[model samples]
Target: MAYLGVDIGTSSSKGVLVDASGTVIATAVRAHTVSRPRPGHVEMDPEVWWREFRDITRELLSGHLGGPDAKGGAGPASGASGGSSPTGVGVGRPGPVAAVGISGMGPCVALADGASRPLRPAVLYGVDTRAVAQIARLDAELGRPAVLDRCGSVLSTQAVGPKVAWVAEHEPEVFAAARRLFMPSSFLVHRLTGAYVLDHHAASQSVPFYDTGAEDWYRPWVDAVWPHMELPELRWPGDRAGTVTAKAAAATGLAPGTPVLTGTVDAWAEAVSVGATRPGDLMLMYGTTMFLIATVTRQLRVPELWSTVGAYSGTRSLAGGMATSGAVTEWLRGLFGAADRAVLLAEAEQSGVGARGLAMLPYFAGERTPIADPDARGVIAGLTLEHTRGDLYRAALEATAHGVRHNVEAMRRAGAAIERVVAVGGGTRGGLWTRIVSDVTGLPQDIPTVTVGAAYGAARLAAAHLEGEAATAAWNPVRDRCVPDPAAGAAYDGLHRLYRELYPATRDTVHALARLRREAAGTEDAASGGAPS
Candidate 1:
């Protein structure tokens, strides 16, 4: 029987079907829009996500994934009986998707009623920082070290508990209405089955609600922070949550009664997709934002970066986030008025190593990871008329690399022993983008054969949890590896030094300016007794 993996990403949701032997049989995608009604606020209708999943699942089951090059219905590399290559394989395999696994962007808190209907739009993970005030309040009340010792790090806007606290403080109505607080996967699983479960990786960041050391919920801590809300049951990522309900089956085109495995965060699933299970293997996810996750033997707590429970059981991970990476690249692409990615890539390649002396600080979406500053803004310097679109494009790429360097250095400082990186996102599709990152960081990267991101990884996790089997053998293999050029590496080292200086030189100044602006807004709000914060 084949396993189905679903990834509920920030910008889209994708599903993939893989056999027990790790061969991808079918793949389908459904895109959704992120609504930004106000500055710094992002949301999505939970129903929209369900619809996308339904469409994608139906598309895949209807033979859309069985291209001409695919194995004659049996899927690639899966040995059929007698090695005869079974015909009409995919045609009859839709109903028997052995297990379903899911993963998505997280560290988010979704407020839901007892029946699992989302009370309000999900308070997104790092993408939405509306919990800043709540983060400050929790840190003050819980003590920084107190939380770090228990949950692996101090609570931030990214933490679910803080977002929960935000609801309690700002929207008490929503808080009172919500019977359960969950993550993306938790909400999805509730829809699939009647279960209210959260996987370990997602649960660990639930701050104060979970005790990482004990690997269970901390009742006292939960009472201390959020006495009003109910936390969900926690389980391993691949553990079966429940069988898909009849209603869910009709909505998603999935078979009724199919087992649904506990889900994980999207970045963790991406890590599994590219064989990044080994200790010290880093996963660089380049999607809406760049998230760096490294699997470590034990958890490491560092102030700047976040240390969380690993995606899979029996391991730990050091994760970091950069507010901008691919976003900046895409933004610059629009600025250049480029018609296609090929032309942009070609232009970026034409420029020299340092983008002809142009440098950029990629804080377009406000920094995360090392700095954790949401107020930070993007900056481009050293631009001149002498520069071309090629130079500007290359600079944008280099800026992203610079951000990665910053994150890597932070992880090193935190005692994360990362030596190899497995690149597993859409960014790896661009040869120049991959090389630039490799050169800038001086780290070789491995790209998997399919690079299906979180969805494929979730499928692998589901495959690993079969009745009885070896986890590693059931997954696909890595295909390509990119190494840094010695010459380019040397050039990037010099640029990286300059990149490091940019933050320190500008941070204090930026903070001061931001404070003044906030004060002015606050003063206006005080006068009106109505203006929103």
Candidate 2:
């Protein structure tokens, strides 16, 4: 039997089929778009996500349906013990997916009916900054100390609580109609099994409403934020959320009553995929955003980083994220009007490390974790007329690395003993980018050969659970590792100090400019009879 893992990402949905021995048999990916109707707002239609998921599943499962072991070598597509392939639920049939697991990009919250269909477009995590007002309200109501103690970090627009408050105040129609609220993974699980449940890893994003130390929901914060909304029952990753219902089976071409495991946030699953599961294992996700999840034995509350319950039970993790990573690269590429991504990458590599002394702050999408500021803006310092596009691109890459250093230092302050870094995501494929991050951070980075991020990890999780082995033991896979060059490290050590000063030195300046820009935009919107939602 094989296990299926699905990842609901911000820009796409990817799936992987893994065998008991950890070999991936099939992989599928489907892309979708994020809409930005107004500045600082990002949204996606939920129905679009559901449709893409259906298409990809059918595409992956169709070939194996009629197998005579369907090896694609001798005969037509027929099952090993098949008579034109049995369509109904049975062992070895395409219908009975042994076990299924899920992962998603999160800190997002969506309202769903009792049936689990989203009542409105999901308020995306990190990308959407409409909850700034709500965050201020939450900060005032909960008091700084209470929020910091409970959440291990100050409240920010990125947290789910503020998003919930946004829905309550702005879109009261959808908020009033909501039966329950859930993050991305929980929403996916609900659609699969008709159950409203959440995994603890994703639940951490809902803080101020969850107690990381107690590993349970904190009632007081919930009452203060929204007295009427009900939070879902939470479980650790790999626990059972529910069985596949008839409707879900029909929708996704799976068997009825299939086991569905409660899953985790995409970053946690990415950690699993990279073999960063044990204490001191650090998983660094390089994607639209930069996320660092380090496994540790104890929960810590640091000034900048967040300490949260780990994906698995009886452990803890220190989490930090930068609002933009690869996204900044994409933005710069567009500004440069590069013909293709390959062109940009090729130029970036040839430009060499440190971007030829160009420095970029990579705060284009605001900042999260370590310092929860939504008004933060990107800055390009040390640019000169002689700088080529390649130098600028390389600078953009190093800026992200510098951001990684900041997060790692914050995690260290939280008492996380991060010795090794396992890097995953499409960005890692850029050789120079990976090496620069290693050089900047002074840490060895392990790069797996088959790095598909969260979806691949979710499949591994499913394989372990279905095969009845210790899920943790069964999911470890190692490939190549990158060690830091001492000479480059010394250079970056000085550069990092300069990188650290750039944020504080220019934060207020950027804020002042951002205020002016927003005021001018608001005036235009008022003249135009208000902005779109």
Candidate 3:
């Protein structure tokens, strides 16, 4: 039998079909972009996710069945299969789908009406910093010390509590009509199985709304924030959410009674993709943003970092994220008019460790974890006319490396035993970024065979639910490791010290600039005769 796994990401939606033996049989992707109507407001219509999921599933199934006409055009189970296709026409039959799994970028806020229809574009996680005022107000009202003790995290742009508060205060009409909250994963589950459920791991990230100690929604806090809204029933990441309904089966071409597993956020799913869930294991995901998840034996609280429930039950994690990582690289590529990544990567490699006396702060989208400064702006120091795009690109890589080091130190300080670092995502395709991170942090990184990321992880979770533990391990394995160089590590030690000091030195000035930009945006919106876009 085969399993289907799909992940709705910030940039694209991907689907993978894997067999019982843990081999990928078919894969498909649909690229999409987010809406940046105003600065610091990243969002996307929920309708886009469903459309892409339908498209990717059809493409993957068509590839597996040899053509769209196979099995009387019922479609090849889409994201549900593994290994090479069996040698025969009967292999295209529709009954091979054993289980379905899904995941998405989350801790997002998608307020829905009673019928589960989205009221507005989903406000994305952490990267959307429009809730700064709400974060401060919530922290003050809830008591910072109490929030840290109960919720396991401080109120920042990352928290769902403040985002909900922002909606209630700013858009009272929409807030009044909202009845249910959904993230990408839960939204998909609701559509497919007619079940309104959320995974515990995702719930933990909804700071002040969920109590990590109790492993359930903190009702008192929920009442204080959004009293009228009803919460989804909580389930573990691997638990079965519900069976697919006939209506959903007709839309997606899957069997009507197929089981669908409740899934968690993309980072945790990425961690599961490479078996990085053990105690002391850390998963460093390099994508649009840089995310670190360090699996720990117990829940440890640090204001600088996020402490949350792990993908599995009875485990904990200390997580940190940079607002931007590969995004900075992409920005440079656009500015330099380069069509491919190889050109930029090759140039950065030749520019060497120091980037020819250039230093950069990768805060182009403000800062997350360890700093939590939503007003922070990107800064480039020590630039001269002699410096080329190569030097600037190298400095950007180094800056992200320094940010990783800063997060690692914070995790260690909070008692997370980071024994092994597993690196995954599109950024790991080129060796330079991984090597730079290792040299800077003095840590070794293990690269897995399948870096397809969260989609693959969702498949694994599906396999585990149907065939048990053995099915998960056979799917992905560590293929290589990047070890630290002693000399390069020494050089980075001094540079990291400077990186730490640079932020504080320029904070006040950067904050002033951020205020000015917001003022200008407000005026423009007022002139346009609407709210801040």
Deviating ranges (above 4 Å) for candidate 2: 65-96, 469-476, 523-533
lDDT, each prediction? 0.75, 0.75, 0.86
Give lDDT tens digits, candidate 1, residues 222-316: 77757766777889887889999998876665678988989898898898887787888899987878989988888898767788888767889
In the predicted model 1, the residue pairs found to clash are 104-266
Better of 2 and 3 by TM-score: 3
What's the CA error at residue 267 for candidate 1, in Å?
0.5
Q: Give the candidate number with the greatest TM-score.
A: 3
Q: Please give, for residues 330-388, the per-residue lDDT of candidate 2 as tens digits.
A: 87787887448777778888877667787788888678766667667899998888888
| Candidate number with greatest lDDT | 3
The C-alpha stretches of model 3 lying farther than 4 A from their native spots are 66-95, 523-533
Q: How close to the true structure is residue 257 of candidate 3, measured as C-alpha lDDT?
A: 95
Candidate 3 lDDT, 206-295, residue by residue in tens: 998999999999999999999987889999999999998998876676778989999989999999999999999999999989999999
- Residue 212, model 2: lDDT of 78
Return the candidate ranking by TM-score, descending: 3, 2, 1
lDDT of 2: 0.75
Best-to-worst lDDT order? 3, 1, 2
